[model samples]
Target chain A: MTVKFNNRDPVYVQVIQHFKEQIAKGYFEPGQEIPSRRELANQLKINPNTAQRAYKEMGEQGLIFTEGNMPSCITKDEAVLKSVREELIIEAVDLFLGSIKSIDVPLSEVLEIVKKKHDAESGEAEGSK
Target chain B: MIEVKNVEKKYGKKRVLKGLSFTAEKGEITCLIGINGVGKTTIMKAIMALTPINSGEILIDGEKIRKESFEKITFIPDTITMLPQMKICEAFAFMADFYKNWDSKRADELLQFFKLDSTERIANLSKGNMAKVNMILGLALNVDYLLMDEPFSGIDIFSREQIAEVFTSHLIEDRGVIITTHEISDIEHLIDRAVLIDNGEVLKEFSVEEVREKEGKSVVDVMREVYRG
Candidate 1:
């Protein structure tokens, strides 16, 4: 739940992004209960008002839901969950491509290096496990 | 809301606050940020009526501050106000005697929250512990508004962090907090609004998130523009 928030972005926006990343990474399961606004504020060391704003925004975006007098939970909608993961992948790709483009690397060359590095990293993970 | 409308104050030959004005609303943490001797504390004292204002007015909930206002608002100075020889419990007792709105239960809760032993004398506590005790005394009061002067100043990182957590926790729930600080890095995310002052006048008064959202500027960025621009 630790997020080193950048000061330029709105805190509530960062909070939403953190939740999106957690959901995409499967760290937060679909329909899993989330901390209340006050609890989240205390945990994140942010203002409670900011936390409430985040929750309200998340609710409007359908990233989370709340029942009557119940705590908020991650969206149980499978399509939305899948889109969250896809959105993160696209964002990472966009960032990588943006930086790689500046280096003038060919698409084929970049793909080869990425595949090699990713495979090696996964192999190392498997070996360690 | 606590409103300071064109408040002016002078110290004998020196005028510290010149037409300083700002409003701190209930359930928001408003920070008064400026360099030293910019009348941040003076503005707070004027709000509390600890120092008489030469002109203009200070109001709590639309009414000028009076004797009854003391019960509705509490001031936590940078240093502990209790006697050095007094034990923490004794200080609590003194507060209970002086302030009718003092809540002993909340005091005990805050004591545990800070992990302080009430039997220890104020003279024996560390600087951080003394600050914690000072915060406890003010927070334990059933007040709607709190004015704190540099609650994070001159403290270790961990102690400052603990005090910052108090701003988020239920201890500060629903109360308007006005804290003066030259340092804004520690609790930038915890404060709702920032009132930047320079030479006893408000240079900028804006919501932290609003500025971040609209202009992509952090509080420090705004401060840089206001103070150094």
Candidate 2:
């Protein structure tokens, strides 16, 4: 899959997001070996140097890990997974809080609305299954 | 790799670029960004042999480049380089003859993607379309690198997005692209690395994430703070 540069946010961040999306989609399983720098760069149509930066950032973020000559792989660390999940939840919570605050809506009303929507969506999914 | 070792350029009394040195590895897109009139385009010109450097060493793939190597790289100056009256097809044919690697199929596809009427004269098209056409040609030429100066300038929002996407697909792996522009917001996400230029000198160079991680700022907000100071 070729990586497209849109000149909107920055290239390295987009690469990081791409990797996360892949992981979330199970395109890359936990502990799965990641592609080498050159291979990933070629596949994404990006510079190897940029690809290197993405890998480095992923390692620092605990999304991926490297050990000796065994190539980098997705991290299956429970603690790291918990942190990422929390981060995603925090972002969603912030947005949800912001919208409710802007309209001066009460927390009770917002939670009730969220619960209703969640139930409806899960109900639809169960019916489909 | 493209290296600029102690390169210098000046116009009359004003020095545009001051002994700058940086390397753009193959398959990377390095964006030269700065406030208005910071010599971003000057660097691109020096790389493409359009303008002479006052003093410095310019190397491409570790070798000094010359006129013969022009085919190896393509340059699109911020100011549209092609003649205004040149028809779209005429410009395409001209480049095809100039560079042997020019892909006619790709060129045809890009022209149509931009929705440029080849039969309609270039002068007749709006200024925005002209910029789009200029970019389409530079990108369609299969080369080791493509250097673009302000490809998004003089264009509205819709065309900018369309043109950017087209340029994105034209990039071949192992080939680098350098773009210089003042409007960093729109194209900020497209660049692999951001090179900040100021007063003819490079202030900083980092991946998009590094800037955010280290400075705790988005590129747009950081740029505003940098230039305002």
Candidate 3:
């Protein structure tokens, strides 16, 4: 997963965002084994305890599962994965709604903006990195 | 009662704590808030006698936090790991044997609240489960003060809600609690007083009501500037 800290929100929210990024990037499939807390902790250099916390949170949200001592795994059910992805997309939309909320943009207008921006950004996307 | 006046700490050449002073009274839940790596934990450790400060005097209820006052205060930091090899059913008993303040009744109640199978080995418990154990021990103790650093950082949001409630009713108002955490939103409504720290210094102290009226900002937002980059 891609974990990054954002001071604007709580750390656990950042963890959830990281999980969403992993899902988007195809590194974590619906039914694949997630990294163990210790491994992730070593990778991120945070306390193993904090990484364990992220895993525990993910499990509680039904995004992943672990049977007691079993290694924690992402829910591999395709339907479940699609649904979680949809939830993430909705969360992102709501986060960015401020841009459109005040303008009272209809669905068609929003789609037009999106379509226009996509083509324009695609031409310059690689340069952003 | 705790006091630190004009205290300073330096890690080699880098100054962590500048001149700082703050007094935490009995029966008060004083929250300490700051950004990361600001030495909030170091101050707590100093209060707990876990770490010695280079220059500072930490007094508890008029007496300095020396060998004698250590037992009067209880500290539960984040990630208090019990020996993974042991079971809670056994370890609870072991803790009872050591800490005379331990109350078996409260511990049992907490075990039920957490729905923990006491027979399950500590290694088998989830992070949330382990945090529950730590929470139980802190509540079971009969002490004048409890200090916790980042207690909510390791638990799920749902569990954090439960723990916050537990903190409200179980926490003794006649005693005291000093909590250091980055999750200010989690405890903003719970804590009565706020202690804002930065670079190991006390920047401001405001009552929950005082902060709202005087600063026109939540304690979290007010303190964010103190630890601002």
Alpha-carbon lDDT, every model: 0.94, 0.77, 0.74
lDDT of 1 by residue, A49-117 (tens): 999999999999899999999999999999999998898899989999899989998899999999999
Which structure is stronger by DockQ: 2 or 3? 2
TM-score of each candidate structure, all chains considered together: 0.98, 0.70, 0.61
The residue-by-residue lDDT of candidate 3 on B144-188, one tens digit each, is 988888888868998887677565453444678888887788766
TM-score of candidate 2 on Cα atoms, chains taken together? 0.70
Candidate 1 regions off by >4 Å?
A: none
Better of 1 and 2 by DockQ: 1
Q: What are the chain A TM-scores of the candidates, in order?
A: 0.94, 0.73, 0.75
Per-residue error (Å), model 1, residue B122:
0.3
Q: Each candidate's DockQ score against the native complex? A: 0.90, 0.17, 0.02
Local accuracy of candidate 1 as per-residue lDDT tens digits, B6-25: 98898997989989889999
Looking at model 3 chain B, report the run of 10 residues with the lowest lDDT sum.
B165-174
Model 3 lDDT per residue over A3-40, tens place: 45433344444566688677866778777887776566
lDDT of 3 at B16: 82
Interface RMSD per candidate (angstroms): 0.5, 5.4, 12.3
How do the residues B111-194 of candidate 2 rate in per-residue lDDT, one tens digit apiece? Answer: 777787887677888878888877778778778888888888878998887756643453544688888888877755546677
